[model samples]
Every structure is written in structure tokens, then in C-alpha cells.
Target chain A: AQSVAQPEDQVNVAEGNPLTVKCTYSVSGNPYLFWYVQYPNRGLQFLLKYITGDNLVKGSYGFEAEFNKSQTSFHLKKPSALVSDSALYFCAVRDRYYGNNRLAFGKGNQVVVIP
Target chain B: DAGITQSPRYKITETGRQVTLMCHQTWSHSYMFWYRQDLGHGLRLIYYSAAADITDKGEVPDGYVVSRSKTENFPLTLESATRSQTSVYFCASSESSVETQYFGPGTRLLVL
Candidate 1:
């Protein structure tokens, strides 16, 4: 079975400061990872994904994530945080070898960007 | 108007009642998914449909039922509502299984 773990419940960062949300995964084979953001009373929006290429993947709204194969971690990052960026973030993973195309999601991390 | 949409954005129902959530996508994607979001659990897939008349169970499918009669419509039905079934339900669609999924605004259901 494939699973994802977001170790932090919430991440607090100041405006204009670098921000990071950590994620780790356990899968039978290689993994397909993705990040999504959800605003209040809104559905999730896709941010980025890591498939098979470079370790560093860039995504929407100036967000990026690094896929470290050795550590089995895919952490979302932003060079500068904005107050509007405060929202709930989720990390999901699917096992590549599995043909079902089912994704296992983490509990989510609430991001609070302080101004 | 051009994206996925879910009907009855908010609903409140009593236990033992039957509730049906409707989802429609204008993109005509081949894959549709139903997920429930709670406080601690980010999102758990209740069911998914690959194409018209082709549906399957996901991580959590015990109390939910899904049907896809057409390419654009995928509705989830709860035969008997329970308090534990109360959550925000999101419907998503993808061009294919490996493609990025687009989600609807979500329907918030309260089972009392």
C-alpha cells in the first residue's frame, strides 16, 4: 500500500520569508507525487507534481517542490511567502508500479503566512 | 461555467436518510473521482469512474455508492446517511488516469 505523511500540523511563516512544508512517502515501487492547496470553502487546486524527471519541480503561484529520492521526501517550498498564501496544503502519492492509479493523501498542513 | 461543478453546495440531513450528490464536468474527462475531506484526514477517495459505466471502489467505499451513466456526470449516493459520513465532498475529473485532476467547488454535507 502507498501512503504519505505530512509531519507538521501547521507551518507559520512571516511575509516575504521563505516557507517550506515537509512531506514523506512510503510506496512499493517508485512514486508519483503531487501538491495541492485549498482555500476556505474551496476545492483543492493542483500546485505541482513530480513524475520522473528533475528533482526540483516548479508549480503554480510561485511554488516549488524538491523530490529527494534518497530520503523519500518531497517538500514544498516558496522563495517568498505572501499573506494571501495562507491556506491548507496537501501532499499525495501514488505508486508507479500499481496500475489502479489510486492516490493516498496525507493529513494536510495548514499554512499561516503572517504579515 | 467551463469547469467541473457539484450540485447542492451545502446540505443537512438526518440519520437513515438517503442523500445523493451530483457532479458534472464540462471538460468531458474520462476519469472522475469522489473524495471526502475531514479535519484530520485530508481527503479520502470514496469511489472513481474510468469511463461511462465503468466505476470502482477506492480507499474508503464502505458506505458510498457511485455511478457514471455519461462521460460528464458522476454522482455519489449515500444509501443511509450516518453522522460519521458528514464531511466536505469534492468531485474531480482528469483527462486520463495519469493527467492532472481538476476539482469542483465541493459539497458540504451535515448528517445529524
Candidate 2:
């Protein structure tokens, strides 16, 4: 079964500081991973995705993720955090069984950027 | 609401009642999905369709019903709404199985 894990329930970081939200995945073959952010009373917005090629993939709003196959991790990172960046983050991986593209999401990580 | 839209952004119903959440996508994507968002569960897929008339169950499919006769619309119906079903429901679509999904505003449902 393909799955994803976001160990941290909450991460608090000061504004302008670098931020890192950890995520790990378990899949049989090359996994298709995605990161999304959701604000209050809103839907999830696509941030970035790691399908293949480069290990470091850049995405919307100056966000990026690193895919490490050995570690089975694809962690979301930002050089500088902002108060507006605070939101609920989710990590998802496509289920490999039966060649299904359905995603399996983690418990989600709440990021708080203090001003 | 050009991209994707959900009707009755907020809804309240009673247990044992039938409730349908509407979802519409403009992209005419080949795939559509319905997921429930809970406090600790994040988003759990309820059902998904590869194309019109090709619906399939997802991880948590019990107690839910869906039909996709049209490509642009995929509505979810809770046969008998339960308090446990109270949560935010999201609709998403993608051009293909391997494409990045685009989400709708979501419908917040409360079963009293």
C-alpha cells in the first residue's frame, strides 16, 4: 500500500526564518508526491509535486520540495517564512497498487509563522 | 467561480436525512474525486471516477454513494446522513490519472 506520513502536528517558526515541514512516503514503485496548502474556509491549493527528474522541485509562492528516494522522504521547504504562509499543509502520494492514481494523504501539519 | 464551484458552501442537516453535495468542474478533466476532511484525518477519498459512468470506491467508501453520468458534474450523496459524516467535503478534478488535481472551494456539511 502506498502511504504518506507527516510526523509534526504543528510547526511554529518566526517570520523571515527558513521553514521546513517534514514528510515521508511509502510506495512500491516511483511515487508521485504532491504538497498542498489550505487556508481557513478554503479548498486545498496545489503547491508543488515530485513526479520524476530533479530532486528539488519548485512550486507556487516561493515554495519547494526535495525528493530523497533513499530516505523515502519529500520534505517541503521555504528559505524565508511569512505570516501569510501560515496554514495547514498536507502531503499526498499516489497509490501504486493496480496503477491507481488515487492519492493517500497524511494527517497534515499545521504551520504557524509568527510575525 | 469559473474554475470549479460547489453549491451551498455551508449546509446543515439532521441525521437519517439524505444530503447531496454538488461539485462542478470546468476543465472537463477525465478524473474526478470526492473526499471528506476531518480534524485528524486530513482528507480521505470517498469516491472517484475515471470518466463518465466509470465510478469506483476509494479508501473510505462505505456509507456513501456517487454517480458520474456527466463529465462535468460529480455529486456525492450521503444515503443517511450521520453525525459522524459531519465534515468538510472537497471536490477535485484532473486532466488525467497522472495530472495534478485542481480543487473546488469545498462544501462544509454539518449533520445534527
Residue-by-residue lDDT tens digits, candidate 2, A45-106? 99999888999999999999999999999999999999999999999998544447699999
Query: Which stretches in model 1 have alpha-carbon errors above 4 Å?
Result: none
Local error of candidate 1 at residue B38 (angstroms): 0.7
Structure candidate 2, residue pairs in collision: none
Report clash pairs, candidate 1.
none
- For residues A23-77, could you state the per-residue lDDT of candidate 1 as single tens digits? 9999999999999999999999999999999999999999999999999999999
Question: Could you report the DockQ of all the candidates, in the order they appear?
Answer: 0.86, 0.88
Residue-level lDDT tens digits of model 2 in B15-76: 99999999999888999999999988889999999999999999899899999989999999
lDDT of 1 by residue, B50-90 (tens): 99999999989998999888999999999999999999999
